[model samples]
Target: MPEALLLVLMAVLGAAVILVLGLVAFRAAGDRSALAPPMPAAYRDDATGAWRRGTLRFVDDRLALKGSGGLAAGPWMRGNLDLGIARPLAAAEAATLGRSNLIQVPATYGTSTFELALDEQHYTALRAWVEAVPPGWNSQVA
Candidate 1:
């Protein structure tokens, strides 16, 4: 009976250790959604010129941005730039612009993505610029 009791205790202890380790691993992964702050409504105006705004719901791993008329289906117009980033926004020019919109740059320690909002004209201009550059030209973290 004593031997059986000892075995049970050891098993319980092992399980406890496993649970602790799992929790630690989860914490290390650093879920972004949980850390995201409430987005400001001031950035959601449609009258703003060439301004891009969106909420990076880190919890959902999604970036939502607004264009002119505060909708994505609006007619293409100049001074509009709407885009999304799947991977973390590079700290380069794109990232710099993101900061102007109050976007928090993701840490380089893990995989991250970003989303963008722009007017149609601005989007076209940005696309053209990206295409004009050599492949792999913007690989550096922005």
Candidate 2:
């Protein structure tokens, strides 16, 4: 009985050591991503004009959108498209007389338009990316 108990204890100890090492490696990977440049575009909108944070990454000429993340900052949705595939639009929906429109992307599911809440810096960055994207398939739904 004592010998069996010793074996079990050894197994548990080994598992714990492996878990700790994996966690350390995961943290290191996260740090490496931090070294990369910030996303070229991030925009948000709220009724009151308060800044809303969202992930709009441009890497290797691809766009990545991460909505509100989970507890560990995992993106709720992850999608990327070549810069050539994105079609810039003045407005996704018909503009009303006083409508304040925010940036909109025509995602696979349909047009996803953000609310009007992005700060000045983020808004400018978004415009730069949109204007730079080369014309592609007419994805911008009329």
Candidate 3:
């Protein structure tokens, strides 16, 4: 009987700890400070069906992704904005993946393709960036 009682106590303690952690995370996710600035544009997260708005920043000839949610409030993953596109972007293709409208950009600095599900405006911006390659740069698809 005593052992059973101890097991019950342990389980209850574990449940309480989990609840506390969950509440803390929920509160943090609602804190505006958690989101990095500049504002956001809507985009569908291809991996997840959920639509999200992320802050896009162009700096030093590179495009960077900031907050995944609009400059509102949400918990951000570490290094979420560390990577960026540094090389000049070239040709881009507007394609469909399953049901999502995707824009595919041939990676200029990496081997993997860069794909994004962006709204009309954001999609246009991406295409414009690709088209911004200097005339001196050879962007032929050879």
lDDT per residue for candidate 2 within 22-86, as digits (tens), equals 99999567545542344423333322333334455444344444445511222212222211233
Local error of candidate 2 at 79, Å?
A: 11
**Clash count, candidate 1:** 23
RMSD of every candidate to native, in Å, equals 15.1, 9.7, 11.4
Which residue runs does candidate 2 get wrong by more than 4 Å? Answer: 23-56, 65-109, 134-142
Tens digits of per-residue lDDT for model 1 on 1-142?
A: 9999999999999999999999988855643333244232112233222335442222232323333464532222212233333233234534535443323221111232223444333444444533344445447848
Model 3 per-residue lDDT tens digits across residues 1-142: 9999999999999999999999989856544332233333333333334434455544434455554433432222222222233332122322222323443222222332333344445556655655565564545647
- C-alpha TM-scores of all predictions: 0.26, 0.38, 0.34
TM-score of the candidate numbered 2?
0.38
List the candidate 1 regions with Cα displacement exceeding 4 Å: 32-60, 63-142
Residue 40, candidate 2: alpha-carbon lDDT: 28
Between candidates 2 and 3, the TM-score winner? 2
Single out the weakest 10-residue window by summed lDDT for candidate 2: 70-79
